[model samples]
Target: MDLLGGAALALGTVVVVVVGGGIVALVVVARRVRSGAIPRFGGTGIHELTRRAGTLLVRLDDRLRDADSELGYAIAQFGADAAKPWADALSGARAKVAEAYRLRHALDDAEPDSDRRQREWTLQIIALCEQAERQLDEQDDAFTRLRGREVSAEGTLRELRSRIEDARARAAASRELLSDAAARFAPAALAAVADHPAQADRLLDDAAVRADAAAAGIAPSGVSSVSGILAEAEQIVHRAGDLLESVERTVRDLEAASAALATRRRELAEDATQARAEVESAPDPDSGAAILDALRELEAITPLSPADPVRELDRLDEAASRLDLALAGSRNQKQRFAHALAAYEGTLVSARSQIAVVRDLVAGGRAGVSARTRLAEAERQLAIAEAETDPVEKLDAVRRAVTHARDADALARYDLGG
Candidate 1:
């Protein structure tokens, strides 16, 4: 077309046809909207989600503004995202929806004070539980030591009882010997009192009598020691008669005293045996070694792996507290020697058990020699403690000695030979 004129004519025809098609399309869209004949939002992916949510919120807001009573406000406050329309709507409404989502995300990201408080409370409760458990373990150890002390007290009481019984028996035997010495006058006194029962009773009851029978020639008289002299004569006569008695009677009393002595010795032996057994069965072990091992293991643990050392450290603290309690209560001269021996034996037992299962640590002979030296030192302390006089002071000294020995052991080099 001669350029511009041809182009203008073609553009006018195109513009008219475009205008007619746009009018028809607008009319069809209007009819569909009015009749509510459009497909549901979920039926197609064509709907603008933000616009729809805005329209729903606007309607929800309108309901809030036109409330007949307070019921509408309550409903709006507790409305669910599922119940509201999420179809096309205005720009401001869409922006509001976007802002609500942003607020929800921000709340999710922000650390709440409530959550931090809950965590703090949880930690505090856990700490309290641990403290209680440690206290319980301490009490258990204290109870065990108390029982040991009770056993030791019982042993001491038994020794005192044996001494008392021996003293009583010695006193009785001395009396019997005195009686034999006094009975010598039985023959002479009996003949003199043959017709008088009262006089005979007096002679037999001479210890309690205080009459002048000895001066009247009823018996041999001695003013300086009348009772003694009379008793001596009676004892002579009794001895004479005893000499004439059968050997079997003498043997019988002798056997009884010997048997009593033997029974006492046997009972003492049994009590000693029982005390040894009680200590040997469940011997107290050192808590330090176990704690060290647990610490080593804890050093190797990683995060989020469930091998947290918090609980382990708690157990170790509990063990340490228990040991402390046992040490506090049992710290005495009488038990210091026993405690040292127990500690040494515990070290040996632990070493042996560890050597059986683990290698390299003790296999190099370094740890073993140091461990042995420590055991020997402990034993020496035990002897020293036993020889001490003051119980509390002796225990304190022993504890210091043990601590020093442990420090030495930790730093010492191993030597297999002298």
Candidate 2:
């Protein structure tokens, strides 16, 4: 009986120690959570922070876009020098927003392993958002002060009417422009800007309706309401103007592409001659064939053909780049470097043109995720190319930018059913 009692007592003691240790661990975990050293997955603190951060991030991004449009108007109303302060404000806000996006992207790309790190990142995002909001608010306040809050409804209404009238005139011209472009280029080539004039007309009609409503005193809050309605109408008119401008820009781009094709044809002939000599010495059949293929492609393109000079330029550039890479294997480093240095500027120009076209298309609402992603990457690569010191690296970056830009254009066109 004595031995049995001793054994039972020892077992009880062991159970108590195990339960006590568990209790101590729970207390420590609870304290750490309260102190924010540990995150509560189910807790409202981090969740609410994340939600608020996301909302503010989106809001700030939208405000930045609106500010960009407003800046253009500001420049129109007040000269560029006078609009400098607003421009500076926009620049500052953009910087903050960019950093915030980087943080958000990092968070999304791969979350931190620790809950504490997650909370910290969330807090940082929230802080950045708040900072951007404050920056924009200050700029808005300055703008309000500049306008003196004394913009009479009559004055605003007149301005809106004048802008709408100007838009209508431009819209007429844009239709003519589109007609000319359509006659010259393929429907797919002009697809990005084909309906811009009609779309602008519809937007102008909506702005006119809003203007009429403002004149009828149908707004909610007297003068403020009238001002608000006029502001919205003005924005719509500006949007219409932007659409018309896009048509003009597209025509300009097409003309530029045609001119570039003429220049590239001459250059291609020169490149083929040089490539043939190099291959004869180095015996690179593949490189020689690439140049020949590019030449054939260019030769096939006559002025009378349904010429897509932009696409042709891309193909020719790609082929030339392939030959360059192939030849680089045989050349000394110094020769390759010298060649890259000379070619980088022209390559950069082509890449920029390609990126700009697709960027405008994406902004016009024809972008899918894949298109947007490629466009962003292209832009990123272009920046890198511009900043890079090594000629070879810069040229490579430009090539990558061009490739990504082309992919973005294809995807956007597919999305647009063009």
* lDDT to native, each model: 0.35, 0.71
* Clashing residue pair totals per candidate (backbone < 3 A): 19, 0
Across 1-418, the per-residue lDDT of candidate 1 in tens digits comes to: 3322443354456445545564453345335544555333333222243344335445544542332233223223222221122111111232333333332333346665353232322232222233333443443454355334333443333343343344334434544543443353223212211222232233334422322343333212211213323444345333322322212232232333234333433433443343334333323444334333433443343322222122222233233333434343324454554543433332222222222211222333456655655555655665565577664445544554444344433434233231
**What stretches of model 2 exceed 4 Å from their correct place?**
1-151, 218-224, 283-304, 329-349
How much is 309 displaced in model 2, in angstroms? Answer: 1.7
Query: For model 2, what is the alpha-carbon lDDT of residue 321?
Result: 71
Please report the candidate that would top lDDT against the real structure: 2
- Tens digits of per-residue lDDT for model 2 on 1-418? 3322443454456445545564454345446556766444455586687798799889988887777678777665444665666766666566656655655665677545366655656665666577767877887787676554324666678778988998899999989888877777877667777888899999999999999998886333333335556778889998888888778877887778777766766676766676666766665676666555655554555554566666666666666676676666556788777767656655665677678778778887857999999999999999999999988999899989988988999998888786
Please report the TM-score between candidate 2 and the true structure: 0.59
Give per-residue lDDT, candidate 2, residue 348. 64
Q: Can you give the TM-score per candidate against the true fold? A: 0.14, 0.59
Per-residue error for 202 in candidate 2, Å, reads 0.7
